[model samples]
Target: MDTILWIIAAIFVIAGVVTIVRGGLIYGIVLIVVGLLIGPGGVSVFS
Candidate 1:
C-alpha cells in the first residue's frame, strides 16, 4: 500500500512536470504540491 502511494505520487509529480511544460502553471503547481503531500515524507503530517 505504501509502495502504491509512492508510485502514485511519482506519477503525479511527473504529470505536474508535463503540465508546467505545457503552460498549465497553476495546475502543475497544484499537482506537485499534492504529490508532495501524499508522498512518504509528507505522511508524517497526517500521522
Candidate 2:
C-alpha cells in the first residue's frame, strides 16, 4: 500500500516538475495537489 502510494506520488511529482518547467503553473499545482492527496501521509489516508 505504501509502495503504491509512493510510486504514484513520484509520478505526480515528476509530472508536476515537468509542467512547471513547461510554464504550466496551474497544471503543476493541480498535479502537486493530487500528488499530495495520493501520498501515503495525506489527510485522506491519515483519516
Query: How accurate locally, in lDDT, is each candidate?
Result: 0.84, 0.85
Best by TM-score: 1
**Which ten contiguous residues of candidate 2 have the minimum total lDDT?**
38-47
lDDT of 2 by residue, 1-47 (tens): 78888799879978998999999999999998888888887744543
CA error at residue 13 for candidate 2, angstroms: 1.4
Error of 2 at 10 (Å): 1.2
- Write candidate 1's Cα lDDT for 1-47 as tens digits: 67877888888889999999999999999998888888886752344
With candidate 1 superimposed using the best TM-score fit, by how many Å does residue 39's alpha carbon deviate from the native? 0.7
Question: TM-score of model 1 relative to the true fold?
Answer: 0.84
Cα error, candidate 2, residue 25 (Å): 0.8
Candidate no. 2 TM-score: 0.80
